[model samples]
Target: MVLHTVNCPPSHPALGQCLRLLAPGDALLLLGDGVYAALAGSRAAAELAASGAALHVLDVDARAAGVLERLADGVSVCDDEGFVALTERYPRQQAWY
Candidate 1:
């Protein structure tokens, strides 16, 4: 499974491209402004839910945005250590900035 990191807002074209390119079992890690997509009741969140990809968001970023508790179900919040672990697990990363 691929580990895909997106660091931009959901409105960005890269986010759409990333979603289109994802294969089954791929993991998506949202960082920076990308964490907005993990919020509950969002169109992006809905799309993500339908994609069947594992979803994660940076804990720090979500906290900063004041939306940690509002994150969609099945989305995980991770710290820096967890980010490193994801990198180690995937062995490869595709970063969309």
Candidate 2:
């Protein structure tokens, strides 16, 4: 399975393209401005919640973006260590900037 990292916002094509290509066993990480999608009650958050991929948000970025506390229920929070862990866990990675 692939680990997909999206560094753009939900309104960007990167997020939508990433979502469309995600496999059930893939993992998706939202970082940088992409963390905006983790906000609860958002249309993007709803779509993300329904996705089959494991969802994660970089906590540092979320905090930096000021959306840490407002993240959707199913979005897992992860630190830099966790970011490295995900990279190590998945042999292959795809990044969208």
Candidate achieving the largest lDDT: 1
Give the alpha-carbon lDDT of every model. Answer: 0.92, 0.91
Kindly provide the TM-score of model 2 when superposed on the true structure, using C-alpha atoms. Answer: 0.95
* lDDT at residue 21 of model 2 (Cα atoms): 91
> Model 1, 58-81: lDDT tens per residue?
999999987697999999999999
Clashing pairs in 1: none
lDDT score for residue 52 of model 2:
80
Please tell me which predicted candidate would have the highest TM-score against the true structure: 1
Q: Estimate each model's TM-score.
A: 0.96, 0.95
Q: What are the RMSDs of all candidates, in order?
A: 0.8, 0.8
Number of colliding residue pairs in each model: 0, 0
Q: Where is model 1 more than 4 Å wrong at Cα?
A: none
